[model samples]
Target: MQVDPGDPVEVNIWEAYIRTAVTHAEQDVSLVELERAAFYERCRNAYAVVATGESALYANLIIRKGVVAAG
Candidate 1:
């Protein structure tokens, strides 16, 4: 997913926010090689965090992923 915040400052802030959030969320999990690979494999299930407070008009993207049945 691409995040274009137009201004460089906004882009930096957005990146920082994402990094911080991910860091906190993974604080309890052991990110080993195999676990990291499995996480990447499930990247399709990830959702975008829209910073609508920064810009409303351009942040109207809706990402819909279809559900798949388990074998």
Candidate 2:
């Protein structure tokens, strides 16, 4: 399930993917861990907010808009 850098993905489809991943995960894992794994798989770096730290469990999921060229 490798996605191209600029591939257009529908919101619903992405949601489903995440849900399925969590549901079928080998062991119980937090949403944060699941998302971070996804970022790593895509070869992308993720920075945690200092304020949130590890306390922010089940936090808001970050969505990448990708690179958009200025017209």
Candidate 3:
């Protein structure tokens, strides 16, 4: 599936958050060989990855309040 880049990329940020719990509160994933759409969907469904990188494989968890507008 071709990720239209319109749906929003999500990610699993628990690990990142764990690492940055007191340091930052965000995580990162290195996806350089995965499909664009697949990466996006994975991130979107992830209850963690709060933020997404320019590509799709890279992502971070956002802390704050509301949902990250994928912007």
Candidate 4:
């Protein structure tokens, strides 16, 4: 089987992201998404699984009914 240059990094990044995302979820916040560009722009620009994946994606934090009452 062939290997991808970004494979190893992607795997590692994914693991970290999963952990972080879980932490974020526990925070009493709503709407969970991945902030690709910002994530990649962080650190020494080492890993960017989401940003450089099939398509760069970002997070949209919606605090649910707390952010705004049901209209």
Candidate 5:
């Protein structure tokens, strides 16, 4: 499951990664499915930003914002 950032992202490999995450999400089945679809959509429009001199493995990072309350 070691993926180097420089390598091209393959469809099957990406799908496998998504499946693995969904499996261990510990969320309700309905919510998992909803989020899974969102993930797939994000993948469909995904783009890679390759940086020069970046040799670190799995250097990609994802940050999601927490829910904000509407006052």
Candidate 6:
């Protein structure tokens, strides 16, 4: 798919949101904790799963972070 170069900033914003969601879901940790590859993998996995059920032409994802109770 061809993306307009003018939309890069918006793309990066979405990328950040996906990465943050992945970091939280996969590791239950902060985004700062994961290395780039691990973080990207998590986001990739999430996108793969979510995209299967996504019906919209424009990308619209909503990810919720699960709460971890303190022991």
- lDDT of each structure? 0.41, 0.47, 0.46, 0.37, 0.45, 0.48
Candidate 4 on 1-71: residue-level lDDT in tens? Answer: 11233545222344455566668664553324334444334433433233333331222222223344478
RMSD of 6: 8.7
lDDT tens digits by residue: candidate 1, 1-71: 23333544322344444465568663432222223345445554656544456553222233334455599
TM-score of each: 0.23, 0.25, 0.25, 0.25, 0.26, 0.25
Residues 1-71 of candidate 3 have per-residue lDDT tens digits of 23345667555444454566556434443224345665566667656653345443434233334445676
* Model 2 agreement with the true structure over 3-71: per-residue lDDT tens digits: 434657433444564787678766553433244456556444544423344332233355433456699
Candidate 3 or 1, higher lDDT = 3
- Model 4: residue 70 alpha-carbon error in angstroms: 4.7
* Candidate 5 off by > 4 Å: 1-10, 28-71
Each candidate: RMSD to true structure? 10.8, 14.8, 12.1, 11.7, 10.2, 8.7
Output the lDDT of residue 51, model 3.
Answer: 35
Q: For residue 15, what is the lDDT in candidate 6?
A: 58
The runs of at least 3 residues in candidate 4 whose Cα sits more than 4 Å from the true structure, single-residue gaps closed, are 1-10, 26-71
Q: Give stretches of model 3 more than 4 Å off.
A: 1-32, 52-71
What's the distance in Å from true for residue 43, model 5? 16
- In model 2, the clashing pairs are none
The number of clashing residue pairs in each candidate reads 0, 0, 7, 0, 0, 0
Candidate 5 lDDT score at position 62? 33
Best candidate, TM-score-wise? Answer: 5
Q: Is candidate 1 or candidate 3 better by TM-score?
A: 3
